[model samples]
Target: MADPTLKAALRGGEFIVAPGIFDMISARMADRMGFAALYATGYGTVASHLGVPDAGIATFTDMVSRMSRFAQGTRTPVIADADTGYGGLLNVRHTVQGYEAGGVTAIQIEDQEVPKKCGHTPGRRVIPAEEMALKIEVAAEARRSDDFLIIARTDARTTLGLDEAIRRGKLYARAGADIIFIESPESEEEMRRIGGEIDAPLLANNVEGGRTPILPAETLKAIGYNVAIFPAIGFLSVARALEGAYAHLRRNGDSHGLETYAFSDMNELMGFPEVWEFDAKWARPERSQAAE
Candidate 1:
């Protein structure tokens, strides 16, 4: 029954819309908006929660905890960024176990070298193809469900180059990756070229303001990629919204500018009524006593 939402989506030829959701509120909103699944964004989480760059500072424990909340909030399948599997091939077994035990549907391990950085980071490097592929094998071997996907992401496009990226992606796929990603390809040509080339279920990273072009969802579906992860879209919206709200308060000593987006509307976005209900219920012992 675990990850049934994700498993069903992966079965059909249609590309899965797995939005990058950082916190529980965003994840629950994504589920309500009819997203088939959730993709945990390492960048978004670090930026939103820690007020830090995604310089590999976010801990695996923090991510797993956030994922647990997301899964509970929506019961939607969550595929998380278990970045570099939090270390090496040896680290992957435990990392996968932690994610599975936390109720995430899948974990994505990347080929970036140890003490890894994000795919868009300039100095990012990948481990040797052979070494990274072994990590993929370990991840799959450790997983309890065939339905629990192991996505092998190769940042080799920016590091070792595209030929090597494709090469490593295939090797990882061969090594037991249920899905494979060639991250941050710069152009539509490369997207089409790579999409045409890979036989395994391919995934795309559609980060806004990244090197990759922002193609429409329908375009990617026609191009045959199985999953498209827009890891920054939700976070970007949140950032812009917060900035707009703060500016209004500072400029006028009021929130008149924020009137365009009401607090009630923002609360609705988070399903805040449910939280209010819980608080209201708990504040009344009479409700609990009456039920008893």
Candidate 2:
């Protein structure tokens, strides 16, 4: 089921800005930062977990297990990417149930066919609008609670055109999608048109260096987006920091003068203090005898 807090926030009419988090460290960090929600980015998660690209290679089990960890570990509501629902209508039903059971508040299912590519990349193809509408219907019906939102994404903007994408967005909304995502709009004008045309809650993909121009939160709200997800920012920033740290170590042959997160802080962040307290309370017989 969805987090009641997030569901309420959606109804409050404020624009939500969700940062992407791929791993526990990122999730924990974002949870502490007090965002309205966190996006479980498929590109970052697949790259971090499997060290591979976001091509349709990861299976449902692989993705859902990670989603479980992310949703369970974080306090913020999680909106996960369930790419193509991992298969047909049956798969869509299973995906919806599994994600909701795993504590995901929302699941994004795109209209891309099997072996789907990243939204900003070329050579991507979408299934027929009617077919994707059925998947949306199955997803909406499968979720146990109305709070568990179904985000319907149409990738037609990249391949077909903005017009088809808008049409499909309206169709998906009619099919019971809680949120509409028309992926990879090439220009700000196109985004404005989407916001103007689509009546339901609209999602904007703010992928840095992608086809869509990354706009500020204020501008996104003025353009009438209900939510904007920065899916690549966290992982891309981490990747750059890692590259720099590794390059410094490689050149110097020893770690010195490199700016980094404190080791002690990391220990606290990972809950080592709780483990130590548990050890003191239970693992030491002397402490128990003394208390007695």
Candidate 3:
């Protein structure tokens, strides 16, 4: 099961749709909802943890700690976004090792420079193709297992153009990367063209309310994408819900009008029933032992 996550995604043209999860609850929820995997989204992590946008503020230690928690919370494979490898070639190697140890099945390292912003956001810059290829080579070599994937992401489309993104993606793939991710294509035609041009297994990043048009998983699969990560859906929706809830609480001094689960219902959702059963089983055995 080392690299079975991506291998299964590549089988039978089944485009794997991994939902972006920032915390353990979201990761477990996505697992219960039966997603193929969980994307440990850097954007979501920064937004959720620091209440800041994904502008490279989070550190490598921060990411590793959170990723470890996410991995511990669920049985699903996690594909982590290792932004710019946290530094140069040596950093890329270290990042891969850390992520692999944290139970990451794949690590996606982008071509954008350190202090990288989100792909959909403006003012993004990428390193030279050869330089990024060297980074990919280092990432591929640093992995502990053959199944652990080295996903090479190029954010050149927003800065240079679609052609340059493809060029860089091909180079990264040739450098022994397992997947080519061309971030934030401007149009559906460009998306199709990327699928056509990049011969490697490809990853499509579908950011919510971002530059790239959100396409269906079936459409992405038909267009030759092996994976699609919706990195902001959970964060955006939860933010909206919390905003409304806070407004209601401030205005009404209570959550009376809001439709929310009862305390017991929420406890069940959080697996309290399982916890209670375990306690009962152990307590009963202890009582029996005491009597004996």
Candidate 4:
């Protein structure tokens, strides 16, 4: 089946809510829970896979592998983070092609320098706006499908200023970016300004405990954002739940309250019935008849 087009889906007034997923399990959970889409978050990937920060350490290959897992494991549209496109314009082209082939519906690139820090974090630098714009143009052309989107992220809001971020956002949009993302908008006023100033569709990075306020999708839509991604929420929730489960086990030497749900519940959640049905449908006919 063809992948869902995130660009076309976000054209309407309602904003798309994409929960951050790092691994196939999270992706499956999001898909089963009926999220509109999935954000293959770089921060989540680095933390989950590498036990490190999103400090530009995740190479293009790492992102491609993680993105491919989500794309193949779930049917939901996935928006992946291609941090700094992993290098220059040529690198951006290569990264775009890999992500597109991996089944991602959209890729988000930022203007931060190599070894880049997360947008909400401090002590980060960006490349020249013109250079980043050129990268965006190359990424726009490299996609195999026109429906595959390029989201241009500008970290200038905290580094340069809101004005500079707006300028960079416009430059990226003119360079053919499908969506404009001004990272780390400090307040509601700045978000409103970004939404009002940028001509193209806007993306809101709604990180938990990040610089941006944790607002609902409706509020972000009213502020003019077409898409909102909660990049670390799922990972954070999973970590906390695991911490509690392990702590309870350590205290009691056995799972007590943590055993509220049976192992069968988890099996059902993971679609064990579907696997059995597939086995029954595809097993050898003679063997099936003997078993019957």
Maximum-lDDT candidate: 2
lDDT string for model 4 (1-292, tens) is 2265566677655578889999877888788877667999998888889899889887887778988778878888888898999999899999999988888888999999998988888998999999999999899888878878899999988879999999999999999998998999999989999888888899998888889887777888887888889999899998888898999999999986684446787787788999999999888778768899
Q: For candidate 2, what is the TM-score? A: 0.97
Off by over 4 Å in 1: 265-292
Candidate 4: regions farther than 4 A off: 1-4, 259-262, 278-292
Colliding pairs, model 1: none
TM-score attained by model 4 = 0.92
Candidate 2 lDDT tens digits, 1-292:
5787777887898788999999999999999998999999999999999999899999999999999899999999999999999999999999999999999999999999999988888999999999999999999999999889999999999889999999999999999998999999999999999999999999999998999998888998888899999999999999999999999999999889999999999999999999999988877466769799
Clashing pairs in 2: none
Which candidate's TM-score is highest?
2
TM values, all candidates: 0.90, 0.97, 0.92, 0.92
Model 3: clashing residue pairs?
none
RMSD (CA, angstroms), candidate 3: 2.6
Each candidate's lDDT (Cα)?
0.82, 0.94, 0.86, 0.87
Query: Which 10 consecutive positions of candidate 3 have the poorest summed lDDT?
Result: 1-10
